[model samples]
Target chain A: MKTQNIPKATIKRLAVYIQVLTGLKRDGVEVISSEKLARACSVNPSQIRKDLAYFGEFGVRGVGYYVHELISSIKQSLGVDRVWGCALVGVGNLGRALLRHKEFALRGFSIRAAFDCDPYKIGEVVSGLEVVCTRQFKARVEELGLEIGIITTPPERAQRAANYLVDGGIKGIVNFAQARIDVPKNVPVEYVDFTHHFYSVAFNISSME
Target chain B: MKTQNIPKATIKRLAVYIQVLTGLKRDGVEVISSEKLARACSVNPSQIRKDLAYFGEFGVRGVGYYVHELISSIKQSLGVDRVWGCALVGVGNLGRALLRHKEFALRGFSIRAAFDCDPYKIGEVVSGLEVVCTRQFKARVEELGLEIGIITTPPERAQRAANYLVDGGIKGIVNFAQARIDVPKNVPVEYVDFTHHFYSVAFNISSME
Candidate 1:
């Protein structure tokens, strides 16, 4: 599939569609119409069709889309069909939560290792993996073949941790810190800021009033 | 302001712009151009202007925007200028991290209370607030006058927690559970799914390759 300049929103919706389809597949559902998919995703049916058209057509006339087939195609398009090894920096509460989250494993993403600067946390085993010192981040990332790095360090140390991850040759960083950290152009960073999430929801709630 | 049909994406961006501006404000920056704001936000200048235009003009020609003024306008538009009381259910690792996050307090969203099903954790005081049982969710939400309910419970309990919150008259729900919970029509739910964030970053990282 020719992927060029796909809108970020579309990419996000694609991920959402994959999630919805995965749920449907688990429910023993076979085929689903764009209308059904749209309802599940809270998107318009035409929009769903339009999004799919970008990656090439997978839908047949009248019969809608085969659930498992569509999911497989999306997984391939998303480059998540293969398992990705990721390293977690900062074994704090947020990092601990993420490491314990089972959805990552289900979606082919695994936390191969965790790192922290705290001496108390260092050498402690969490989720069956020992929390290594952040000083060893670059070398450890390389040694573990980690592609993505998750930053859950405190705000003051976030940028430094990001720098370490970049130096470690990480392809991406999922930063949970509220502070924005600069990274190289080639390395994308996704901010999973809980504060921003709270604001988004609060604003949405306020608008309802 | 005629806040009729503003897209969720627009509202989310507004929240992000608030974050960027807040950072700039702390740095003692007084004024900024849309181009600069867009660069800081990782969005196009035209898109930033378009978003602001939806809520009426905030930028002056040639001089661009007054940093403080723009933040005020965005906050007002987002209905976050005033403090919002939110009830948090499930004081797990992720929830604990959120309660400890200083950004939320800075943004005027305060966690007025917390809840959990665990007997050991139920009566424990965290961040100056005692954790109540989920059984007390509805009554406590009412007593606290919480405008929003945040669900960080496990998948199985999410829907039930949502039910109590809704019954207690929460204007919205910010759910972090991996499971999708159904809510009332008037009450909107914002999902804070970490898996989706990971996939978004993964797709972007894949595109860089």
Candidate 2:
């Protein structure tokens, strides 16, 4: 499959679909119609069918989709069928929360190593992963064969962290820091900005008034 | 402004622009051109102009935008010009991290109250806010006049937390739990699913390989 041709929005919905399907599979839901799946995901039924059609037909014409089968297919398409080792930089409260986040492991991503520059935090063990110096980031990431880097450092240190991650041969980055760090075009970076959601919610609430 | 007519993507972009503008303002950037702002935001200059046009004309054709003025205009349009009091349910690690997050307060949203069903955490104070019992949710929210509810509870408890928030008269919700929660149509809910980012990065990396 040439993923480059797939719409970014479709990829996002595919991820959401996988999350919904995983939950349904856990609850013993074997089959789900497009309407039911759409309702679960807060999307239009036709939109779900359209998004799924991008990859290939995964649903029966009239019956529906098998939850387990759909999950496997989507996971395979998203390349999350196997574990991807990841390195986490900055061991502050947010980073610590992410370290203990079970969803990442459930989704086949592992935070194998942690890095920090603070002397007090450098030797500490967090969520069972020892905090290593940021100066050793490139070497440690290479040693652990980590593919992705998660940046949770303060805004001021985010760029430096990204530089280290890039130097460490990270293929992708999930940045939680508020800073916008520059990276090569080859490395895909996803920003998890909490304020975005807050602003949306605030706007919606204020609009109601 | 009847925000209803604005594109959702525009609203999201506006949030991103605010983040970038805030950083620039902190660094004492007084004015920025459309092209320069677009480069900083990783967006097209025309797209920025279009999004801002939805609200009003803020940028000078030749002189560019005054950083401070643009931030104020966007914030006012997004209804984040004033502080929004919010209640956070589920004082777990993720919830605690959110409480310590400075971005929310920086962007005019305050987590004024925290709630948990756990007896051990009920009386605990996290990030200076005392964790209250879920049983007291409605009363505390009413007393504090919190307009937004942030759910960081475990998946199983998310719906209950949302229900409590809704019953407490919350106008909006930000759900971090890996569950698709049900809320009234009038109440908006945003999902902060970390797995979505992981899946996208995993797919992009796989495509590269």
Candidate 3:
């Protein structure tokens, strides 16, 4: 699929759509209209059609969309139809939380291994995965064929974790650190900063006043 | 200052610029040009100017923006100059991680109280705050004067927590749960779904292929 040039915001909504559709499918919903799906996803109906049109036509004239087929198509477009092994760096509180988060496995991204520099955390078993020393990170990533890396390290250590992920051949990263880490051009890094979320809410509430 | 109708995206980037400017100020830098700030923030200079223009003209013609002055101006516009007390519902691993995260306090959002339904977690201190029973949630929010609520609870319990927050008079929410909760029109909710971040990286990597 020629997936280039799709807006990052649209890519984000695709994930939300996947979640909404998964829920609909589980409820035995066989078909749904764009308007209904938009309501489910908290987006507008026009946006639902526009985002999906970037791929191809899946909606029937009268029947709306087949819930099963749309889920399959969105998953395929997202490259998450198959399982992707992931390596997590930093077994700190946040890392441990993500390790225990059940949704990742349900969505086909598995945290196959975890690494940390802290001696207290090293060799600890969290969420059934033994915490490995950071020195073994590259070798372990190669062994496990980790396609993506997740960094939950403190700000100071985030850059080093990214370096290890890159050296280990992991191409994608989900960084939760507040500090921005520089990565090579080809490596895709997604930041999940809650501080930004906090500030956004604060700004919004202040604006309404 | 008339702050109506400013795009939420611009408010978000202003927060980013505030962080960048704060860092520059700490480094003893006196003044910064939009070009330098743009490079630091990974945003275009034109966009930075446009975002600031929504607030007011802060940048001088030739000297660019004074780091200290711009930080104060942006903080005033975003309302992060004042601390926002926050109540966190759920003391699970994710909730514990957030309670331990120091960046919230550093950025003017304080997680004052934690709540959960788990008997094991209730009354236990995590990150210096004792986990209160969920029944105490609304009362604590009233006592603490919490303006924001952070929901890290499971999907099933998310809406109930939102109900508690709303009843307690929380006007803003930063929900980390996978579930969607309906709030009143006046209460603005911000969702921080890491799955969206995960899929964004996956899609970006897939597009590169």
How many residue pairs clash in all the candidates, one count each? 0, 0, 0
Model 1, runs deviating above 4 Å = A59-63, B60-64
lDDT of 1 at B32: 96
> Which is the leading candidate under DockQ?
2
Model 3: native contacts recovered, as a fraction: 0.72
What TM-score, over all chains together, does every model reach?
0.91, 0.98, 0.95
A23 in model 2: Cα distance from truth in Å? 0.9
Off by over 4 Å in 2: none
Per-residue lDDT of candidate 3, residues A132-187 (tens digit): 98878888866787989999898779999999888888889999876677899899
Task: Please give me the total number of clashing residue pairs in predicted model 1.
Answer: 0
Mind giving the per-residue lDDT tens digits that candidate 1 earns over B1-209?
32657887787778778878888988999999889989888899999999998889789889889999999888787777889889998888778877776777788988899989899998898888899987787777667779888898877788888988888888888888766778878887887767767877788777767
Of 1 and 3, the candidate ranking higher by DockQ: 3
* Model 3 DockQ, alpha carbons vs. true complex: 0.72
How well does each candidate reproduce the native contacts, as fnat?
0.58, 0.78, 0.72
Candidate 2 per-residue lDDT, tens place, B38-134, comes to 9999999999999998787788879999999999999989888898899999998899999999888888888899999999998898999998998
For candidate 2, the per-residue lDDT at A56 reads: 81
Candidate 2 i-RMS (Å)? Answer: 1.2
- Model 3: colliding residue pairs: none
Ranking by lDDT: 2, 3, 1
Candidate 2: the clashing residue pairs are none
Which order, best to worst by DockQ?
2, 3, 1
Number of the predicted model whose lDDT against the real structure is largest: 2
Every model's DockQ: 0.56, 0.79, 0.72
